[model samples]
Target: MIAFLKGRLVEKTPTDIIIECNGVGYQVHISLHSYSLIKDSESILVYTYLQIKEDAHTLYGFVEKLERELFKLLISVSGIGGNTARNMLSYVTPKDLMQAIASNDIKTIQSIKGIGLKTAQRVVIDLQEKVQKMYGLEDLSTSVYNTNAEEALSALEVLGFVRKATEKVVKKIVDQQPDATVEQIIKLALKSL
Candidate 1:
């Protein structure tokens, strides 16, 4: 079990990275969240999960241990695989994913590119209890109204902006100002986009 890797970063992209440990170079698949965290570093320590298959062995890396743990939990579901789990992490932060699973937010899970309604439901049903147990549902009650964010995202999409890119920008804006209005978010997102 290659638990983690600490070495000089040889190469990096949105989906993967190459790290030189000793004299060996390891290609590690990573999600966007991890990439954003470790992209600027020349040297990094990434927590990894090794997936073994009949044809290949792959290493998935995470910037945080909790994200790696969430990836493991995601892949443990019946219809989820390594790529799908990685996509889920790429689409949303680990904390948001945990919250979605705990709150049974099938819509959010289904919004990820490769996931469908049934798979999203399965993910929620299979992991809801575990997620609630692992990360107690304490903050579930304080739901922030994200209608402004949703409206801003919709407006951006209607104006021909890609949802994926617009989402990142809108999320950043919302994170920085949780109580921002729809127009404020859209204006801010427009500037960033």
Candidate 2:
């Protein structure tokens, strides 16, 4: 099994990138999030999974081993496949994905493209315990990074911020921020509270 390939990126398509390693150009299919991380970088290391069939072989690449493992886990469900799994990974960050699964937030998982009630239910049924164990989310995430806008807003309300103030603060921060981090959230919450 090829664990990963460290190579120079030679070409990138909408869905795949070619990495030149040891005088070989390896084509790797990547997710939108991975593509954002790659951004045409020459030197890149991609953890990989090679799928072979009677007619052809395909290689899928991930930014990290955990992502590769998550992809495989998604495909292992009875009705889920590689494409659906990749699509799920493309839009949602792994942390959010794990949080949703561990919290039994089926609506969040079902919102992903190509995932329906059946697939979402299967995901919750098949992998809920595993994700909870892996992420230590038995308490449903106390990690600093776990707070999204909605969660942070709720916390601020309990901390004496008015409902209107909380909503305004969350809205202002979320509107201007491209990325959500715990520090940023706390700072914003403190400002409002």
Candidate 3:
């Protein structure tokens, strides 16, 4: 039941961060969204969920309580696991996910590279009510779309979108179209890849 951690960040990468608290180092997996907000010499805090299995005791951290809650909700879905839960957070924020769920916007949810229509629908059906209660179903789409381009590019790499593939796609698309949306960038990226 580790609710949160406050510490000096000692290391940072796209997938994980190491925080040194009271002379102890805690390695925690993170989403790129959280990684962007973390910087050098700054104290940071993250809500955490610990999963203990026979072979592993893994700690997953989130920059926001909503993200942590969503992570819990994601993993609770049948056939979804921690990696997929984290992946969902990588591309979608708490607000956006909720809005999509509330509105039954399966297309938006399915647009993420790895998710399918059925999975998207299932996720929305399962979580819409809970999210509406929690956040009032505010419009999270624009914010999610804006922050997600950069974050999703990083996450794309994690999901096996090759670096060369991403670089070629993002650079060309962003260069030609400064105001391109995440979906547009991804579409162009598919062509590039």
Q: How do the predictions measure up, each by TM-score?
A: 0.72, 0.70, 0.68
lDDT of 2 by residue, 47-73 (tens): 998877687787889987778888888
Give the per-residue lDDT of model 1 (tens digit) for 1-193. Answer: 9999999999999999999999899999999999989966778899999999999999999999999999999999997999999999999999999988986778889999989999999998899888888876632322232577778888999999999898778766776787888899989888898
lDDT score, candidate 3, position 156:
71
lDDT of 1: 0.88
Candidate 1 residue-wise lDDT at 58: 97
List, in order, the clash count of every candidate structure: 0, 0, 0
Best by TM-score: 1
Task: Report model 1's TM-score to 2 decimal places.
Answer: 0.72
Sliding window of 10 residues with minimal summed lDDT for model 3: 137-146
lDDT computed for candidate 3: 0.76
lDDT of 3 at 132: 67
Better of 1 and 2 by lDDT: 1
The models' CA-based lDDT, in order, is 0.88, 0.77, 0.76
| Predicted model with the maximum lDDT | 1
In candidate 2, clashing pairs total 0
Q: What is the lDDT of candidate 2?
A: 0.77
